[model samples]
Target: MKLESHQFIRYFEPEQAAQISQIAIIKKFNPREIIFEEGDDSDSLFLVLEGEVEVSKRSGEGNNYVVITSVKSNGYLGELGIIDRKPRSARVVTSQQTVLAKIYYESITEILANTKGDIVLQILSFLSQRLRTVTTDYVNQLAYKEKMTLIGEMVNTIIHDFRSPFTGIQLSSSMLKELYPDQESQEWCDLISMQVQRMLNMAEEVLAFSQGDTTLYCQLIDIAKLLQNFAKLNQVYIDFASVELIVSVEEGLIINADENKINRALQNLLSNAVEALDQSEGKIEIRARRKDQLVEITFSDNGPGIPQEIQDKLFEAFVSYGKQGGIGLGTAIVKTIIDAHDGKIFFESSPSTGTTFYLHFPIAKID
Candidate 1:
């Protein structure tokens, strides 16, 4: 049923309703016709009178438009852009042959000048609601960006810590096999050596969380303390996920860095690792040390390794590895934070072999 201006007065005041009836033009749009594209400067408000309209935005690749929502008969659209004088953020198109009441910006102004105080209040109230919706959407986007940035930083730190131990374990294991010729006890020694090497590899994976070649701030930092505090804060998630976490870092190691951001970055990486494991029994290892002018950290997990195809772009925002319901923002956050701290990250992985990240930060000058 088509709603008359008087019947739809709930959306506008009596005086405003009268003004709309006088100036609003009823226009018919063909099916699949575009009402306006994003950034179009048609400052007009539209009220759907018949059929439906869809609002959508062009996806990142521009090949598709992700529909935000739809408007049915008696529903209104476009007031926000018209009132605020901003470009339309999304396109609106007719889903069928649609009839709409179009009120141009000039008509709205004239109506407001002639309208009663109560009618003006009603219009203002509707605009306020639209503003709130836009503000909430903006806040969500900002938060997602911040989270991705933090994840990136953590990956960088993990790589740095893993490099030294990985190098040592690789070199030491080879030497140990050469020096100890007894095959009987060699198997057990090899087991211990293998575990150590795995630890080193995990560190490298964590470090790889940073996307590319970037400068990092070196610093002396107490790695053990950092892990302990992080574990305490995230204990609920750890317990809920049935994940085991291990930490190893000397107390006196002072690493040069923006330690606070590093902590946040690591938190994001670890949280994602735990989530990736789902309901399975997951284990995470964190190790760090200060060597020469560098501070290194590694974060490794015993869950499924990243898929080969996605592993290459895992650090890019919204690049998920076929994980159901995954938004793919965690590793991106890890990269941004690390970049801000002037650090580097690297990753290593194989299916079922698990994944590890290495992070490196430069140490503060001893002098």
Candidate 2:
């Protein structure tokens, strides 16, 4: 990462650099060393000659700083103060053993005073680029906030309007099941009920996770019955004739968790499994077991598997791989809900076998 002064000071004439070198203050830094802090009026601009430094700003919260970006070798530093003698607004700390060449404000002022000076022009270019970047970021952030607010309001309206129709559909499906004489018609009614329930689960997940309405009412969950119900529910949305969905949840396995949230997390995994399957051939297997003080639930699918491009950031928000029309919130919400329950989630995937997601939850002891 060692960089020569010429690379960074290319905007300057050879004579100008020779003049600045006469008053240059070269400083070496160790890892985690601070170059300058916020509000410091030391009045020095720096050129990074080696290593990397993290640039961060003081957060709105008291006594916290958030990282903004990194400055590597050949990059200019403290350009925000090159023109006017303003106090440092951002903190700069060395991320590794570093070396910086510092030029005092007095020297820059001397250069700026020169009628044929290139220093002022270079500083102006730096300032304008910075201003443009900041403005763009601010606009993007504001737009994102606005979009999320609109979506939240829309979800609220949809939730209120959706429940009545869903309830009516459930009720009508129940009535139709009893009245329908043909077995095929009865199965269709059951399918309707299952699809409606899936929609309800998805809507609830969106409200609770996306809208940040996290109010978990924990209850003792029967694992075996839940698995049986999962199998029944999954059969409705997927092509059972082509995909083999096998679930073996041992009986008597119990846990205390938010039933709705945990169910939502598990349903996400099942949905992912179904989606991963090829149209004509795929297999999904679910296994739940208790060992020592932890319960393990695994969902594995035999499909093309997760794309290599997304394996590292698999659970990061909005990082979808190759799924068509995917918003990419499924795994992120799954991780969030599992973390809330004091559980851990991870996955192993490759082109060799399909993808397998593992969920580990602490076993709750019943006195």
Candidate 3:
């Protein structure tokens, strides 16, 4: 049968339409035949003249069918290659005896050039509709993934925060049991109370984290003093890794910022640096200075650097290096805090020299 009047006029002008019809040839395939395979470099559009085809991919033990859009007498397929210049994403197989009008890219382009006015508008409109549909689908997928990630983070924070209170409860309950010798009932009651308090603390932390109330108030923070405090606090981790924490900052270097957030960011960097050292003797240099009204802080560690492939996405949520038991949210949280403060954070690293995280905060301008 001839190309439908509406389909022909929709894609090309009368003259070009006739030319395309003359040049196009109908190709037939048997059942289970390969019409096109994923990654094939064939930029051709196929208008089904008869039968059906299935687009799918092989996964695990079975074939996963993604799209089963039919291509009946006047329907089409293979337009993705023409638009994106990419290979097919799935294999198109002849589910049954199939016939299609194969129009190569050259012919399509020739027809498009010759076509004018509403004919061009129609073709473009069709392409635009298809593009919008695909874009919407992709955005929805990303949104779904983001929702799942947030849920996972909430669960993890609950578990992490619970550990502290749980440990405290365990210790307290054990002490109570030792004090109440032969009073088994009282000891069990103490244990239950401790466990309940532990759960309450865990619930509170989860609620706070989920509510996004982790950021504290802004104040004038002394960078040098903060580093000293952090060093003392994390001395155990530093010593366990045989790492030396060296701090260098201009005396009296004060910045107007959220002290808690900055401290958290610094802590994250230090933690990452220590982990990167892999329990080896390493040197971590924390330096801060005021450069042109910007407070620049640098965390440099002498350990194995990040790989090139993962560097670009280092600050993205849930992206972890080779460290076991590492939650990749630290850098992501640091970036989030910096961005909220209108500051910037970047890093540079190499295999032998290790990595350095550079954070810059604009000094509060005074009248």
How many pairs collide in each candidate, listed in order? 56, 0, 0
lDDT against the true structure, per candidate, is 0.71, 0.77, 0.72
Name the better of 2 and 3 by TM-score: 2
Worst 10 residues of 2 by lDDT: 1-10
| Tens-digit per-residue lDDT, 257-345, candidate 1 | 65555765787688678877746678898888776666778899887888888887888777876356866666876787676666788
RMSD of each: 18.3, 8.6, 16.5
Order the candidates by lDDT, highest first — what do you get? 2, 3, 1
Where does candidate 3 stray beyond 4 Å?
Answer: 1-216, 365-367
Ranking by TM-score: 2, 3, 1
Q: Candidate 1: misplaced stretches above 4 Å?
A: 1-221
lDDT of 2 at 347: 91
**True-vs-predicted CA distance for residue 13, candidate 2, Å:** 32
Candidate 2's residue-wise lDDT over 135-213, tens digit each?
5655654554455556667766887889899999999999998898699999889888877877877776776765555
| Two-way TM-score contest, 1 vs 3, winner | 3
- Write the residue-wise lDDT of candidate 3 on 244-353 in tens digits: 89988887677778766676677778878887785657899999899888989999988889889999999876678857887576787778778768799999999888
- Which residue pairs collide in model 3, if any? none
What are the models' TM-scores? Answer: 0.40, 0.60, 0.53
Worst 10 residues of 3 by lDDT: 202-211
